[model samples]
Target: MEHPHPMKDFLVRAADLPWVPQGSSNVWFKPLRISPATGSWVNLLKVAKSGVVNRHRHLAEVEGWVVQGHWHYLEHDWQAEPGAYVYEPPGDVHTLVADVDDPDHPMLTLFSIHGPIEYMDETGEVAYVETAETKLRRYHDYCREQGIAPHEIVF
Candidate 1:
């Protein structure tokens, strides 16, 4: 009747989670879950303006669910709106862009990523890389700046 590992029970109001700038204007992310062992993570990505977010290739499969507004990849014709579930297979490369015609409401999506994302530039050069360790570092930095414990924000 009682759970042994209370910390394992994850529950938090989405609004209460702090959103950290993803080194880009109008782009923010709130990490939900992170697993160091598997290098996997779940995060909420928010984009407030219509523009190119990034061009990245995943080393492992990635999954996402649109929570609000819409977005799509420039390389793909399909669009993801609220309630849409998307899957990106390993080695998939695409440019993520947000549809922010409605400035009042931004696009938000929940993403579960299983490996590092290799960000590319317009020339298809590897500009940078983002992995679970980087995300964890960012999360810890954000929590430290906000005066909140890391355990309080991440599971």
Candidate 2:
């Protein structure tokens, strides 16, 4: 079967994109790709300190690859280090924290998310939610603030 739209090939250099803060001083993200149709996206998550990034549950499956340094989930004992590929099943809840033994270098991971993430409080109560639209808005806002043309990073 043939596809309706031509496949698009794009490139995003981490060094070329601006790092947007992700609700914390130590945690940041660089959006790589966003799909409005399916609410899917890819991003680079960076953490500069050994601290909790968030407590969240995914509505869809999530996949990630550790690019540099390491991180672990509070609910799990296994650590995701450089070159490690991690997977999160739908509806699984966990708190992401950086394993920053050396502050000089931060942890970097590439994540492919399929759905919205429901951010939760320490008591397991819903705090806020992050969706594909919200992420796209953030990316646009960051690019505008930095005087970076949206086309330069977003496709």
Candidate 3:
């Protein structure tokens, strides 16, 4: 049996992707898909022990699945460990923290974001914004700086 449009399906080895720093020494991301049409993106976020992903609000829906280690939001009491799933509705603000005991294994989560994220300052002001396009540009910029050929992740 032959299936049509097989090329439309993407198979990626996540391990083969380079980790791009997220303006932090211990936080990085590996983008899997960047969809400009829907203003969405999917990526794996890695945070080392004691790393904080900062306080941010999602302008749209977002979902994540913990793939490695453990993490939790400072605003919430529950912790997310391996195999745990998380969902964030629009306008939900929270600060992500990774305080795992293991120093060698960082926390990794695969996230599917449907819109932009507003990084907030201490006074609740929007300090910066991150979107699918910005993430794509960041990946490319990191690749160029490291002398690595950028992969085509745009959809």
Candidate 4:
């Protein structure tokens, strides 16, 4: 199937997306489409260089395209290099860390989705978990090292 956005120029410049949305850098992301409510989706990342993304799983079969640098998660440490694509099945829980040497290098990715992803809690209970706020606080130290503000609470 062919999907066309409202405007042909519905694209986000790498420079435009914030390094940290509202000063939270851990889960900073920008959607590619002009209006992100629709099904077609993409995200830009300015994640921490070294930290745990906590033990949470997703309902959406998440897919990623690495635009720059790399990262390591569980089962497999994905090298989100300049040009590479990685896919994670539903219920996959793991951590994420940017390349050690260079933290400023942002990860520009395109994440297509059918719906919002779900996260597993500490007891392995499946529920809706919004990672934005929690991821920020969880990796505050790492964010500080990178000069990005920390998340408000631990999710």
Candidate 5:
């Protein structure tokens, strides 16, 4: 049995994607999908032990699934370990911190983020804003600098 029409889809192995640095926080992200039309992006984010992901507030909802190691928000008491699912509502500002003393395991999580994330300074001012477009640009820039052809991730 064959379908009448061919499937219109994009596919790429995760191993083929490059891990682009997410600023100077000892964090990196491998972009899986980036949709400018919906202002959403999916990425696998990796954080080194004792790394800080900055204080940020999402303009829309964000979802995450821990794949390895553990982490927690400075504003929250509970920790998210491997297999843990997390949902962050819009406008909730929090600082993400990787396990402080875990030398063996760094935190790795897959996240589906919608809209832009505003990184706030200590004075509560918006220092930077990251959006799907910006993420795509960063991925392209990183791949270009590394002399690696970037996989098609934007849709």
Candidate 6:
């Protein structure tokens, strides 16, 4: 099926999007902020590498689909596999967790969230320390180690 929107090229390479899960097990997330003009807000994320997307809330009603791999949230651990979909209402606490023994093997995820979702910093801080930049660095190193020409970290 062809997606109607004019597909915007991914300027950032996968190697540049380092996946990381903060101590919450195997949970690595590469967030792609979508254009609002697209009518529905969305973002592509890579999960299932020993990571945990701690419980969080959103202001707008949200929905999601699992392109691949699996995740568990709330008291229920639902696997939105390659062809599954999940609709999470606004303000619902979503505790997402993904893990893979081999860092070389990671689960792929495509999530389209309507409205806006914000991370409820349990640490009481403004932002999480290990973030986009940190992951980028890790991805760069991973690419270099794997003999893939490293992609310039473009912002």
Judged by TM-score, which candidate is best? 3
Clashes of each: 0, 0, 0, 2, 0, 8
Writing each residue's lDDT as its tens digit, candidate 2 over 1-155 gives: 88898667887777777889889899899888888777988999989988997789999999999999988999998999999999999999999989887878899999999999999987989899888889999889877888887644344
lDDT per residue for candidate 4 within 19-104, as digits (tens), equals 43523445565433322243333446656455444555665677777767667776573456767887878767765655645566
Which residue ranges in model 3 land beyond 4 Å of their true spot? 1-7
User: 99, model 2: CA deviation in Å?
Assistant: 0.8
Q: Rate the local accuracy (lDDT) of all candidates.
A: 0.89, 0.88, 0.90, 0.53, 0.91, 0.55
| Of candidates 6 and 2, the better by lDDT | 2
Native-to-model Cα distance after best TM-score fit, residue 59 in candidate 6, in Å: 1.4
Q: How far out, in Å, is residue 134 in model 3? A: 0.4
Q: Between candidates 4 and 5, which one is better according to lDDT? A: 5
lDDT of 5 at 54: 89
lDDT tens readout by residue for model 5, 1-155: 98896556888689989889999757999999999989999999988767788899999999999999889999998999889999999998999998846656677899999899999999999999999999999999999999998898887
Which ranges in model 6 have alpha carbons more than 4 Å from their true place?
1-33, 36-40, 123-155
Q: Using TM-score as the measure, name the better of candidate 1 and candidate 2.
A: 2
- Of models 4 and 6, which has the larger lDDT? 6
Best-to-worst lDDT order = 5, 3, 1, 2, 6, 4
Best by lDDT: 5
What TM-score, computed on C-alpha atoms, does each candidate reach? Answer: 0.88, 0.92, 0.93, 0.59, 0.91, 0.53
Q: Is candidate 3 or candidate 5 better by TM-score?
A: 3
Give candidate 3's TM-score.
0.93
All-Cα superposition RMSD per candidate: 3.0, 1.6, 2.7, 8.1, 3.1, 6.9
> Of the pair 1 and 4, which is ahead by TM-score?
1
Scored against the true structure, residue 67 in model 5 reaches a CA lDDT of 97
Candidate achieving higher TM-score, 3 or 4: 3
